[model samples]
Target chain A: AQTVTQSQPEMSVQEAETVTLSCTYDTSESDYYLFWYKQPPSRQMILVIRQEAYKQQNATENRFSVNFQKAAKSFSLKISDSQLGDAAMYFCAYRRRTSYDKVIFGPGTSLSVIP
Target chain B: DAGVTQSPTHLIKTRGQQVTLRCSPKSGHDTVSWYQQALGQGPQFIFQYYEEEERQRGNFPDRFSGHQFPNYSSELNVNALLLGDSALYLCASSFWTGQGIYEQYFGPGTRLTVT
Candidate 1:
């Protein structure tokens, strides 16, 4: 069985600053996918970024990027130039490369962007 | 284009009652997945439907069943609901590329309260 762990329960960063959220997963599969999703108070889940296990290079999407260390099984999300809109519940998720695989999510970390 | 859409933004039901939640996949998306997110917790995978059949399921009881229509719309049916079933149910849609690398677009979840 695979499991995702998000160590931080809560995090805060000043606007225009940077913050990093930690995530680790336990999986036996060699090839898989890791993701970060943000859910606002409106309760909509939005994809922030994703990383492929085989890709040595980390994934980056504008202000959101991931530090995927395959050997350590650690995938972290770094938000640069944080804004008020970044205050939300962020979840780390895992999925297998199979087309029909189900996604597993971590407990989540609540982020607060201080203005 | 519109993203995923769920019906009945909120629902309240009594214990032991049954409830059904509907989801319409985004345009051109053929796969639909259902997740249950408890308060302050991340979403848990319930199941995934593709080609009008359930292809994958998580550690959920049989009471949680689902169906995918020909048009790619899906429905999650929970029978004999318990208080533990009260949570925000999210529906995500994605296209299954042959390579098995595609991002899921989530819908504004349906909040189900079992009292």
Candidate 2:
């Protein structure tokens, strides 16, 4: 069983600043996938970024990136140049590499971008 | 690409009643996964449909069942719903390369309210 944890329930950042959302997971499997998903007021779950465990290089998507520490079993999301549009509930998820279909999600972190 | 789309953006059902949700996968996507998001929590995986078969499922009860059509569209049925079933039902789709990448695109979700 894989369990994902998000310590921060709420986070706030000033406009144009950077913010990092923490995420940790307990997984017995060595190969898996980590992801960051954003849900806005509309409650639409949107993929922000994804990191493959087998890849040493981190994943970056525009202003969103992930710091994946395999040994620590941590995958944190860093949102640079934060905008109001970035304000949302962010969730960390996990899926095994061998069976990528079954996914597990962490409690979300509510991010507020303050002007 | 229409992305993943779900019907009936909102629904209201009574306890012990039954409910059905629909989903249309993204263009060029062959996999559809369903999730349940409780208020103030992350979305929990329900099931995943690929090749018109249920490839994986979460810890949900047998009351939850689903079907995937040849068009790749899907339906989720829950019998004898409970108030605990009240949540936003999200549908996500992804292209299956048969590898570890499960970078899914999510829909706006159907908000199911069980009274």
Candidate 3:
């Protein structure tokens, strides 16, 4: 079975600063995917970013990027120029790159952006 | 195009009761996946539906079942619900392009409170 781990239960960052949320996973499968999701107090879950395990280059979307070290089984999310709107609970997830697969998620890290 | 959408934003049920949740996938997406997120925890995969069939499931028990329609919409049914079943049920949708990776879109989620 595959499992995802987010070591940090909570974190804080100053506005306009950068923050990195750490995540690791244990998976025997070679072809898979990693993802980061954000859930605000409203409970609206939204996809922040995703990375392909087989790809050497990491994935980035605007100010959000992932540091994916396949050999280390680590996929951390980096949020640059953090804003108050970034305050939320972030979850790390994993899924196999098959025709159909279920996504496994880590506990989560509650992020608080201070102005 | 609308993103993923779920009905009954909030529900309260008692133990041993049955509950059904609905999900409509994003436009152009043919796959729908369900997840359960407990308080202060990340979302855990429940199952995935494609082509009106269940293609993948997590470690959940037989009491949990689901169905998909030709329109790519889906329904999740949980029978004999226990107090532990209280959680936020999420629905995610993605396009199966048979590619390396596909980004999934998530809905706001339905909060199920079992009493």
DockQ (0 to 1) for model 2: 0.75
The candidate that wins on TM-score is 1
TM-score of chain A of 1: 0.99
Q: In model 3, how large is the Cα lDDT of residue B93?
A: 93
- Which candidate gets the maximum DockQ versus the true structure? 1
lDDT of each: 0.95, 0.90, 0.92
Segments of candidate 1 deviating more than 4 angstroms: none
TM-score of each: 0.97, 0.95, 0.95
Docking class of 3: medium
Relative to the unseen true structure, what is the C-alpha lDDT of residue B46 in candidate 2, on a scale of 0 to 100?
Answer: 92
Candidate 3 residue-wise lDDT, B2-58, digit = tens = 888899999999999999999999999999999998999988889989899888888
Candidate 1 chain B, run of 10 with poorest lDDT? B94-103
Instruction: Give lDDT tens digits, candidate 2, residues B2-82.
Output: 778999899999999999999999888888999998999988899999989999998899999999999999999999999
Off by over 4 Å in 3: none
- Which whole-number lDDT from 0 to 100 does residue B111 have in model 2? 94
lDDT of 2 at B21: 98
Standalone chain B TM-score for every prediction = 0.96, 0.94, 0.96
DockQ, prediction 3 = 0.78
